[model samples]
Target chain A: MAALSPPYLLFLGDSDNPLSIKIARGLAHWRPELCIGETGGELSLGLKKMTPAQGARAGAKTFIVGLANGGGYFEPSWVGPIIAAIEAGMDIASGMHQKLSDHKEIRQAAQKHNVSLHDIRHTAAAPPLGTGVPRSGKRLLTVGTDCSVGKMYTALAIEKAMKQERLDVDFRATGQTGIFIAGGGIPVDAVIADFIAGAVEQLSPPADPGHWDVIEGQGSLFNPAFAGVSLGLLHGAQADILVMCHEAGRTQVKDMPGFPVPTLKDCIDTNLHLARLTNPAVKLGAIALNCRVLGAERADKHCAALSEQFAVPCFDPLLHGAGALAESLAGKEE
Target chain B: MAALSPPYLLFLGDSDNPLSIKIARGLAHWRPELCIGETGGELSLGLKKMTPAQGARAGAKTFIVGLANGGGYFEPSWVGPIIAAIEAGMDIASGMHQKLSDHKEIRQAAQKHNVSLHDIRHTAAAPPLGTGVPRSGKRLLTVGTDCSVGKMYTALAIEKAMKQERLDVDFRATGQTGIFIAGGGIPVDAVIADFIAGAVEQLSPPADPGHWDVIEGQGSLFNPAFAGVSLGLLHGAQADILVMCHEAGRTQVKDMPGFPVPTLKDCIDTNLHLARLTNPAVKLGAIALNCRVLGAERADKHCAALSEQFAVPCFDPLLHGAGALAESLAGKEE
Candidate 1:
């Protein structure tokens, strides 16, 4: 929950897989203005490649670990670069499961230089249990058919489109990458199971009736590994609008073979059924598809077919932007 | 998770509410042979009223803090009693959110006596992520229409009945009360949200084909505050047989004022539907009703009506001893 100082120097930590550097990619794409330079990875953000010292000299306020491996580990090789960043007088912020302060060198360096270390994954104190009490404010939640199926992107896009239309809104991040982009957020997945919904309830508390909290969703309700987190998010969200996000052609849940992705209809029905426990009037606002694998024509056709089938606006938020989806919510109660 | 040494002296901590001492009540009711004496509460377990020193002399190996309040807190008043128990040469086991070791006096006393302090609510290391892959062995899960609707009681009853019938069975606990009764369990709700299912999966690993792991379910899938925990338990359980537990005449979820308790039919349909994600062959073996509020005749009539309605055997597991429900599962695949 540390508020990270921006103008970050992203550290990619030599991860070769494109998926591993998603933290860097997401930051570069969403909050490009806050990014100063890049380090370690061959992959480019079209930003200047600079060492921690050089980036610090160039006015980068924080050094960010922009790599997200499977286990969220702090790799040994990354320690040198992190300490260098601390020596250069830049504070360190990480979304990794391992706390930066747990490392002796980094902890001592940060103490000596008086630089703050932000571990976004670790919550400071236990959040209060969810009361299921209805709170004021309009909220839109982007749910997914599976993990990494564009829930965060769709949420961000909706927030942007709503803002452009002069609607009062904010994108509430629930994951690490989203946290970095938004500068602060509750890492919902890392929270204790009993407090997952409570944490979400705390994160997106009552706001102005006209304001929208476009909450980013987590795992799918069908996913065996994380359905709990997903359901907690749904209950705590108390969303007036739920935007379903799904990949166009993916069949199985990520890394979970033999468990097929739930159909959009099934997803909509289940999410609505569970969400109604907290917010009785919750409704499906739109379908946000990750059509990255499809050609433009095919993606459009797929979206149109889904829209007709589900009787809701459907589009790839990243590809087409969320203007239509935002427009669909124009008539909802303020 | 700590494996508590038995012959316990249950400490009720002066809690007047019967519900608050459910942990002690449950332990005494289910495993009376392991309990030595009781202290500090007017409510009788029909055991001897003995001080910690007297209980220790009577061969108590552990002093159990048997109270479970709204918030799992360590009351200042209970500190002296806990320290007394530790000084009396007994290991201490607590299910409260506050660790017994957190108190300086308690820690020093335990250290001086060389007695272990077990905090059941805290896991030592993170569990692996759930893989969603089906594992061997037959598993039965007891799900509910709301929290505290006798899911644990029903599961324990089934386990006992199965054992009496010379069937291969084990009662797998997931909460603190159940954990104390079962000696050890994962305390699934205290685990990280992402690992709720994973912890369950670890707790009930693959066993012999004929062995049955009777996994105790957590919160109801219909409870707004805890449906996520329920869903995770369902998925990780991969139960071949699900016994639906409901308290008769209850109109709303526990502690949540407005959310209505899901009907038996809705509870069955939804639990089976969600549980099928990890367990496709799952079946509703029986309905276990908590008919404590009804007269014997009325309870029988209620069970009979529900049995005929759902086409599944229905009975109060505690009242009727789960024999019929055990017989209903006689033909399940081994």
Candidate 2:
């Protein structure tokens, strides 16, 4: 993480959509601000609403809207709440593919209000390709069975725990949400096909031998549509340690019905094998289970059983914290 | 290889430099156009020279200068020969780090002559990072023990042999000389560091499983300064089979002190170990020796001895040809 962003007003324009609902919930659980609220539809999360004046009073200087699947389209209907937030003197930060600055009325209002617009989806300057040169440091990448299966969440949790232990660690964000939290990172998916690994390399450059770079992983190798990007990142990251992430209740790959959810061991083996291509010493260090779907008791039992099976620490990052994984990493040889 | 350029008058400005001499000799050995002629110094190779008007008559539309270490600075003496060529109604194509098009005098003269200035150093659009997704086709990459050790030469020769055998093959050029002959390729070394591998990936995209892409490799892993680019290309190429290219009688790594030249077996093992990080199935297929230093008799004996030791067919691509290597590849199963 580089820069710390200002406190933000969470704006879930339409909470009925899956991407919007998921993001709103995730933000509340992770980075809860006193100024949290959703516009349009139902209030899906347990955060109280803040009036524009109240939000501003609470040091909320920016409005953040995290809506995936909404690529660069500013719907005509959601103008009121956004403009109201802008007029309240809050800058806007959006993770949607569409740029809010591109909206005619929104642009005019923001200009009048003198509020800055930060489109998280606006990709950074193209990154040079990874040299695949060996560097001094340990890089741990979180790989999953499918997309959005807690890879970023697990890495963030591990980073937080590592920091608590006073270990020199850094989080290398890859996707939009991770980038927003980290304050700086490339939107690897949006980059041209050739430079994916190069972009990852830029995000996580060589560091000191004692340092650990916790890289946020993207799509899974099992994902038919995005496996190339996954392989690119795997090689580009040049990771020495790997963490397998999986959603507890997933039975099949997201969007691909014919593909069964890969076993944790299989995923670990595949990842280790791929990672070894660039870093022959790469090894799977831990297993992270996203068990929000399963109750805490069930999640604990599942993790314990898997930990015993795989001979490694396994836990739900959010529920049980990342202590075991962080401890295992701290013991790793530089 | 994409677009075919008009025939050009090859210019070896001050052919004393190794790069200048190598390129001049290579062009003569391969693409021999009656229009081609060396200028600005002594003629080094055994190629017939043509007058500017005679070159034009022979369909030479441009003056091609392949100078390494020249960057973009045209020497004071070079101006005379270059301008003379331009005045003779010839466009200019240079593979120098500096842009001739940016040179005031060169630009003005080209403008006055109504000739286009092609600066090969002007990098193409930054390539996107690789997704590491699996494309359908089989790709073979030629890796080497050092720079300019016959990686490109071997790939080109193998491609030629494969095509003659009626196999579906494509030659993917990664450097300047290859790009010049191929007409359409990104000058990977000129590209920003991050996009090197991505650029290679773009040069060789996925195709049908039977389609084979012969990718030209770059720098050696043993070379400390350029290992990153080498590793990037190895992974980005997503090669299924790897061909090791080495020069005969080399005792040490080029320009790197205290580092002894690695054995062919060791080079193959190191390359396979790195390549397996991306494609687990990647295997070392053959060895191509650059035996120009050793004439025909010694070249064949050295290759035969190395072949007996490595258990892989080894040959000087220019002399004995790449028939064995191509045949071995043709027999490979997907």
Candidate 3:
């Protein structure tokens, strides 16, 4: 999946932990016009921090890394700023699980600067296994109650409020900071537990029952370490809409101390009972939360008491933008 | 994990599918004194068939590949009989997914007969992730309702009926024909979906409190392509006894056509509710089943009607030898 090369430039190696630079705060907050800023950390994302030869003479074209610890290693003082961003011509992506071409000075300076190194959690072939087979589309997903609870910022704020309600959505990405903010996905936890639900059924395939997709979710079927990549991304997301996402007052389970953090009505009733074994009319539809530890009037009274105790549309999709969870999936039941 | 050099020999490569030679009928039915027979298929685990130079002149010492099929490739007509069992001196194991050192003539005939190839579904390091904490001892696992049902032959017949009731058992293995009949394991679907429950919590760690371990189990939380490696091997098998297994008339979900095959009381109440997220005293201690398509009085009246409908002890741990499921886990409650 090497097509990466963007304006990028992030590289926050010494992780001053804003949850280890969440892939440079998810590409400076959702591909801020292909972000050409930020260098090491203090956690800024307020853009302009340059210096990989001043963001390769301000044109950038990829140099990402953007730290995401807990074993997606690749540190050694970020290999001299990634061979000085491959000697300043750029190209060297990384959503790490180590392999900037397994670092021999970033693979001979990206083969003597002809650049290209992507490794966005590596997946090229080997996927086909999952066949609960039903796919037609109109997905949604999100799920979570642990492991960085925001499920990729409530699935990119419900794919930007289902693309401002005109629908036919997309935001699929499944980690490595939503595959470097949707440049591409399927890192389903660096796949290969027999192809995490066949790489989320080849990252949300069969679309167009009025298309939707959305997806992005992982870890936490009461996470005892990535509930089997969240039950193979809920049986390869045969999701007919789920959402859930939680984090408000999380009580344990992030670094998995003793476990806890389940109840968002037992993680939306065990993710709609294992996503009804590959969507038997799955539901849940909303609840996002991540009230960044509350207090916007207690995160709007804990999202209106969990939208009246799980009836549905709860909020805080990064401070309420999933437009009431895209108007409860445009009033579901499709 | 290596260590394989057994009397082995198995091979059965032109797969005449007895479920693709379930790892040479699980090492000729549970390590028939470290098996020293059988060659290419004609389905006979009745032993003595020899010819990898007459099973290395009857001293064998590893030639395994006992076939599994479904993408564990390595076939080009079994690479000339795995380079004629590495030029007959042996050392070659393989629970496929390719890699018999990616066959350059079986890695130059095991580097010109210095032997050793053992890719029992490769796993060397990088495991640590699952920290749902709780590790003490007494684990039991063996889940399933699909994916080669008889979770590793009911966890090797409950570790050979808890070592013929002297207890303090061990077994463990996670796949690749239970790591070629338990010489080693952790191939948890060739790990890395964020380390399938930390490689089954480092293949059953923290032993001694009346030690049990058992473990072996993969794929099937009602199998939508391996319910996330059966929910990360039920939260890294913090199992305080689970058994479950099932097969008896198999309904569906093996080659995944329209799904089905779930109910044995919904796969033991969803594997004791996702194995109580790192086992909050998990239970359902029996019910192995695999009645190999019945008729021993209909598999003992279908294991006495599922042992009086799930009040546990169900049977057929290879036609009744898990000594009443190890006396229902030695009358449980621990």
Candidate 4:
């Protein structure tokens, strides 16, 4: 028998959530033969984890995981912790209350090997430079839940961070396409404008390898924007990475994968990780957040939990500062 | 008679365009005397100029003016030059090309004062920031024909320019009350959110004088949001001024004093100027054009004519740049 690729996904939600199913299916499609896991443990015992899983379906293990992204602790709340421990360096997003606060059994299991234990309930410190394109330098892109949420917030944070890093970065970057959540239907002007811009970009040659990163959000695979148009923007900008940022705890996903859209953020942590993942040629990067909006104390508690959970540093932009976060990310080079 | 306050506004629209009439009725229900535009140039001018005589009867426009706006340039043979003549500060905004440009006498008449020229034909040049905000230090709040025609563009331009000037401005300043351009109906959540947020701000002591601005765009007055909560948002964000942005030409605002909410590019200048004259204190600001999206070169000529005609700046934000235009507005202080 041929060797298999290790799993990198743990999908949540029920059948009613077509989006969750779509996500799982998307990963599987990219690399069939990937193992689907309803249950998981130290899959990499006494061995190093696989580096990249390209078409490896070869031996990847995907978890259907547990339900209750909204469930509490002491009540079989081992999903987040278990995934965290096994993933080790992997980033795991969690939902609901009481993360595995040192449960004897879970801790014992994690301690035996080099696995890590964490709980990813709170949202990302803020979004990271999701538009994965690394060669262009760190950039930001996001789709808002409304005109609010954290799109502008995170974008502004990154701008500040870039300034601190003293990088010759210009945050004047635009998706050329924007939308406002309303019943009147998608703003056709925005759609047309964005599409034309994207098409023009793809038809042009890349100025440099991974010249830019294009982060996008909102709409679903069914929506022309999420699928049809977004690609154009990413192509136009030569985005190196793709990031998606959203609140979790019980957030919903709505899409059919491979609509041709690139990387997306469903939770905060993954959103940050996405920044670094783009162009693996450079630093994958770290995360930034807001303590005031999220409540300083609460954010601190969550940041600690998430750091352990994802094995990546988590921060709040409003408190430690975007510049501070940037410094931390520099040290996270893979 | 008591001196009238400048808090009144007049909205004009047909089944196809109703913003004008809505603002009028809204004011009539409150302090009717301060509402409507009666005495000024439009009503006082000849046949082409018109206004809400009905609103006048209610004693709203004790200090009124006539300024009609619409979208005639969008029809068959209209072009940009003509649009320019109007938005350049064309007087009244209505009628077909046969009246303004085609008809020599009417074209000459359109050249008269008190009108603006230009249409929402092409984009502006310099962004509309310092110029758009009336006061360089003030923030922004706006509404457009719809969500698509450069609303956010204008806002962002203004924000960008302001930052360049070193103003420490905040946005959604109140985090609640925001300007809304009611269309068919408002969503309940939007209204509630605005209302709750507005209330919270109001309850709090006067803020420490923020340098930020709050702007909102409404979908509709009939929206569930309007009925329950958003109504308050509309009320809270409504400053002393209420200017309508329209695309107008002789063909658009037909039959004089026609329905407001002009759809062409040429009429914007005339519309804004008239709105201003109706209440000098809250006199209208200016107009931005979208020539490429609306008409042709003739409209541009007309828009330029209107600008010469009214002596008020009539421009296209995309082409002219929102900042350059907004910068000029610095001189218009009371």
User: Which number leads on DockQ?
Assistant: 1
lDDT of 2: 0.74
Q: Is the docking of candidate 3 incorrect, acceptable, medium or high quality?
A: acceptable
Off by over 4 Å in 1: A14-20, A39-43, A51-57, A69-81, A87-89, A331-334, B14-20, B39-43, B51-54, B69-89, B108-113, B331-334
State the fnat of candidate 3 relative to the true structure.
Answer: 0.88
**Model 1 deviation from the true structure expressed as Cα RMSD, one decimal place:** 2.7
* Model-by-model DockQ, in order: 0.81, 0.07, 0.32, 0.01
Evaluate all candidate structures by whole-model CA lDDT and list the values in order: 0.90, 0.74, 0.81, 0.32
Q: Using DockQ as the measure, what is the rank order of every candidate, best first?
A: 1, 3, 2, 4
What digit string (tens of lDDT, one per residue) describes model 2 on residues B1-334? 2243567687777656655556556666666753365554665565557656666666778777766653456766676777777888888777766677767888899999898777665654767654455668989999998877989899989988888777899888777777676665776655544455567778888798799999888877655445546766776787998989999989877765545677777778878865764678998778899998998999989999989988889999989889998887777642
Tens-place lDDT digits, model 3, residues A1-334: 6457678888877766677887778778887999878887566768888779999898988888867778777878878988998898888888777878877878987898898888887886778888878978678788888877778888887888878877888888887778888887778888788888888888889977888888888777887888888888888888887888877776887677777786778778878888888888888877878787767889999888879987878888767788887866666624
Residue-by-residue lDDT tens digits, candidate 1, A1-334 = 8678989999878867888888889999999999999989677778889999999999999999878877777888889999999999999988887888988888999999999999888887888798889999899999999998989999999998888777889899999889999988899998889888888899899989888999999999989999999999999999999999999889988999898888888989999998998999999999999999999999999999999998888999877999987776765533
Candidate 4 deviant stretches above 4 angstroms: A1-5, A9-22, A40-334, B1-334
TM-score, candidate 1, first chain: 0.95
Over B47-163, each residue of candidate 4 has an lDDT whose tens digit, in order, gives 122233333333332221112245433233223323333333323222122233444543564566343321111111211110111222232344444323444344444445545
In terms of lDDT, model 4 sits at 0.32
- Candidate 2 displacement at residue A282 in angstroms: 6.1
The docking category that best describes candidate 2 is: incorrect
lDDT of 3: 0.81
